[model samples]
Target: MTNRALVIQDNHHQTFDNDAFMQARNLKAEYCNSGTDALHAIKSHRYRCILVSMDMQKENPVEIIGALRHAENTSGLSPTPIIVAGKDFKLTQSDIGRLNISAQIRSHHLK
Candidate 1:
């Protein structure tokens, strides 16, 4: 089985960096630059994990999260863990109430 990962980023540079990192770790990384394409990828393949840039401009992050949830529910696919990245990735109480997120880690905590 291939160790595959999907990365969604609005910025090309960020996407390139993420793809390089994943490749270095021996993962088959696929890149999607827009929410629509991300959603399409989610529906079409089983990714080990998904990396989503919170700063995606083509579609709101909340909307993408909702669509992911919907895809999980409708397709009977296991929930793919999503790593939301960006300095502005703060989730409000309302946002937390809307999605089933497990935890939030500060960027500084990452090695």
Candidate 2:
């Protein structure tokens, strides 16, 4: 089975360094440079790991994450593990949400 990961980022350019790190680990990543793109992609594919950024969509990644979770809740589809990437954002809501499979990846560590 392919261990694919979906990463949602508003600025794919600003995320290059982190992408390289994931690639080095042999992770197959599907990145969307905007929330709109990510939402469209998720409707078409399944990912084991989901990485979301707070700065996405000009500062509305929360909506993207919520949308994913909502899809699972309403459709009874299996929820993928999510890794929220950001500086000011916290995982509290994601933890309590329907997506029990989740984690956090700080953006600053992209250095």
Candidate 3:
């Protein structure tokens, strides 16, 4: 497993303070402020985990997940595990099946 992680968020403030957690675990963390930038980073780097915030301002979180899936499929890369973060995300069953979300981290649980 890579000792790296990618966090996709519209803002720099991470709900879980993931950077510090990663540091404590001796892992490297990278942050992307946009979905496009996140996709580029995913293609170029290897991450042990991908954490995406559902409360983005510019792009829809579902679309970002779709784009990431498409990129992986087109490039013949193994599926990268993804975790979603939100305080009030309510994805339908179809949406969850489509994205294959591995897990969710609530905003409150971060603390």
Candidate 4:
């Protein structure tokens, strides 16, 4: 595994933090509040994997995924891979056929 991961999570979970995950996994992790913030982070650094909250910014993490996959200047990250996380089960089947999302993680059993 690479030593870096970027995490985008909603503000709803007051205690939701990627620090612990980063420390435990020995990764260089960065956190962002919204899809926009995440996009900025992506442009600044290259990550092996990106973990994003599913319902962030109104169940629209797909847009962020799209933006990354379609970045004009950074076109090769199209296959970088992303993991979507959320508290709801509905996101598992989210119609993200247009986005290049890699996986979905349910918050109840989030690792």
C-alpha RMSD by candidate, in order: 3.2, 2.8, 1.7, 3.2
Assess candidate 1 and give its TM-score to the true structure: 0.75
Give candidate 1's root-mean-square deviation (CA, Å).
3.2
Q: Relative to the unseen true structure, what is the C-alpha lDDT of residue 19 in candidate 1, on a scale of 0 to 100?
A: 50
Residue 42 lDDT in candidate 3:
84
Q: Alpha-carbon error at 95 in model 3, in Å? A: 1.5
Local distance difference test, each candidate? 0.69, 0.69, 0.83, 0.68
Model 4 scores worst on lDDT over the 10 consecutive residues at 89-98
Please, what is the TM-score per model?
A: 0.75, 0.74, 0.89, 0.71
lDDT of 3 by residue, 1-111 (tens): 788888888877655666655677677878888889988998898888888888787889899999998999999988788888877788888988888888887887655
What stretches of model 1 exceed 4 Å from their correct place? 15-17, 20-25, 93-98, 102-111
Model 4 scores what on Cα lDDT?
0.68
**What lDDT tens digits, residue by residue, belong to model 2 across residues 11-99?**
76653356665776677888787767777777788886787776565757766777877876777767777777666655565354644
Better of 3 and 4 by TM-score: 3
Candidate 1, residues 18-39, lDDT tens digits: the string is: 6555766687878888778888
Show where candidate 3 strays beyond 4 Å: 20-26
Worst 10 residues of 2 by lDDT: 92-101
